[model samples]
Target: MSNLFEGSTFCIHTFGCQMNKHDSERVAGMLEGLGALPVDTIEEADIVAFMTCCVREAADTRLYGQVASMKNISVREGSPFNKRLIAVGGCIGQRDGAKLTDELPHLDVVFGTHNLGSLPALLTAAAQEGGHRVEVLDAADDFSSSLPTDRENAWAAWLPITVGCNNFCTYCIVPYVRGREKSRTLEDIAQEAQGYVDAGVKEITLLGQNVNSYGRDLYGEPRFAEVLDAVDATGIERLRFATSHPKDLTDEVIARFGTLRSLMPALHLPVQSGSNRILKAMNRRYTREHYLDLVKKLRAVVPDIALSTDIIVGFPGETEEDFLETYRLVEEVGYNQVFTFIYSKREGTPAASMEDDTPREVIQERFDRLVDLVQRKAFEANQDEQGSVVPVLVEGTSKRDTSILAGRSPKNQTVHAPLPAGVEIDELIGTTVSVKVDEARTWYLSGTVVNEDA
Candidate 1:
């Protein structure tokens, strides 16, 4: 088994959320442990894997297209990359299982969300059997976050405090595919944070389906605030989390924004819809007023907090008035950014079966309106940063201009700064720098170093 595929290389193309990206890192770590090298292109690799997402319908279409392309390349009898093993894993793999193999005959292996550890062995089986293998586990005894990781970014890491979802919003497919809520022991999480710090990681975002509800299944109450405190005590420079449900964002959790020194000032609370009627229909468990109230509390505690949110523009029964309420809410609470989505019916979700008679034009119009409002607010927020000195965690050179380095401010705004004299961009990839904002755009800010020594 040790020499089965020695000296081979693998390329993993990951699609979807950060969790899937983290999973791909673990996969790479596992592959490297099996004596595999990482390759940039699938054409040059002996193994190709896809870590997929099933959150939206388009992912399925994209997956099919990619597989079809791979089939053309890898399935040829005399092709140079003919020996490559094509593996599929994550939510899409977990959802479709053997059907993926049936649909795409060239696919060699399919592993599930809970069985990322089994991938190497499954590939081995596929190679040995001269046939395909499917290893889709309902759940795993251990968390995938515990596996070795080959992090792409040296300055940051994702530490999963919990996995799976407890809040099965009718439109969501996460709980079905990712399974029920399971919180990692607090000790494990804290220890992981300390490890990241020791490894030169300056920032870590705690990962979960609903981060604010962390520890509820195990501790009988949500202890996310305490988790934040534990990680903050590790002396990590920056802390953040993602996709927090508006209902589960308790006052204690919101209060931590003001108290935790390392915690970033940005929050991504997703309020799916703005009308109470639409909210109840989606089983969101919180009303529009409740969400606005939480926003007020967050601002009250931390006046300069930068807020962002997710907005679903068109649900099954959303009315013109319902969309106006969403528009009103967006105007009422100016978000630093809003991730707008026109509702797409996922096959397994309850919403897929409901009547979606809302015209496509209406949905598109609402989506455009929301997008415009969000962009305006974001531009205004960035503009406000002008004539101010903000601390940014330098992430490396900007993709748009290599001469200009970029980093993120405490509020999670991208601040692109010119490299100071005789300083290389690589040297500041992980350091915090004080940047004086000189220019502000809708999505980012351009600044100069205000205090290099600071």
Candidate 2:
């Protein structure tokens, strides 16, 4: 890597999941190593990069709109760099490749999920040739976790034990764009986690497309439980994982919730739909009964665990009965949070070609009903915590009011507390404090700081 980007100001606009966010962080770290300074906004940047997502149609629209809008903006007038360069990477870049440069003629560099390390070279080439330089590799040459990172939080980190997805759910584009599952060696994962602990990180979220399926490709069977034990052994204060598939979630992993010291009492097991028919059509590999049973076992082991899920309401050919089954499941689960989505057809996905006679308005109605149920269920779940004391890992002050310091509880619930009289906000940013809940809203809990040293 040359110092071609030396003294340049860069800003990265990230749009997507934790994996994409982590990728952007690595890119930032790489640029900074080449002497580029980070700026808050694109207008101030001599180099603008977009870490994009193609999971939903809305993400595609937003990325295109933002990239197009940059055409009229220029680099900061007083900056040393003479011209601004725009680059796009992540899922969309992998999916679209050189087509992006054709669509957005101003694009200078286009790298993909598999070739993040090539971005700087591509940028250098673009600067020399004054033309687009695109590199989209079909397979990953290295695990991204091995890359340098400029994490957003000094005290928290996203640790990827695996990358990509093997399960091709009918509605998802993840497996297509991210490619097949690739698990990093367990020894490598633990070493990185210990490094984070040594660097004073308080939290680590193990990231993967389907976390419960980690190590299956490399080890010949899922060893996610062993991965959890290794990370927990690093003595990090908190540990979490995301985007679990119901089919791959085993009893061994569930058992860790009751035993692991650093594992948080929270899980995000995405059950896309509740109808067995729709589940089969979506190729989820788990029936409604099996999913409910898993939930039961999870609760039996860790009763106070905060459960959250992703639900897609309007899948192709979803009937009224199917929606009702989903409604009933939501009522039964009483999740702490629900990420609801109306299905959007992706060009290469199997569900995109499925027949559907249902009217748009009918789907909209089902979506609205699901949203209503989800909100009520979330509110009820919060209400259950009204008088309980929670230890919150302070993130920062709330955006709406600086007087209120905000953080997350063990269950990953947002908790707000007034800043104590003598304590500065920065002092509490990375520390855990005991909060006594006074009120519970639909989205968060209001509390007072009861113990700062907690």
**Residue-by-residue lDDT tens digits, candidate 2, 126-154:** 87678899999999978887777899999
Q: Against the unseen true structure, what C-alpha lDDT does each candidate score?
A: 0.89, 0.92
Clashing pairs in 1: none
Off by over 4 Å in 1: 74-82, 452-454
* Residue 346, candidate 2: C-alpha displacement in angstroms: 0.5
Across 1-454, the per-residue lDDT of candidate 1 in tens digits comes to: 6576677788899999888989999999988888788989877788899999998889889988987787556432432233678999999999999999999998899999999999988988888776989999888789998777899899999888888998888899999889998999899999999999998999999999999889988899999989999999999999999869898999888899988899999998888788999999889999999999999999999887899988898899899999999999999899998888889889989888989788899899889988998999899878789889999899889887888988899999999988999999888899998999999999999889976565
**TM-score per candidate, in order?**
0.97, 0.98
Off by over 4 Å in 2: 452-454
Best by lDDT: 2
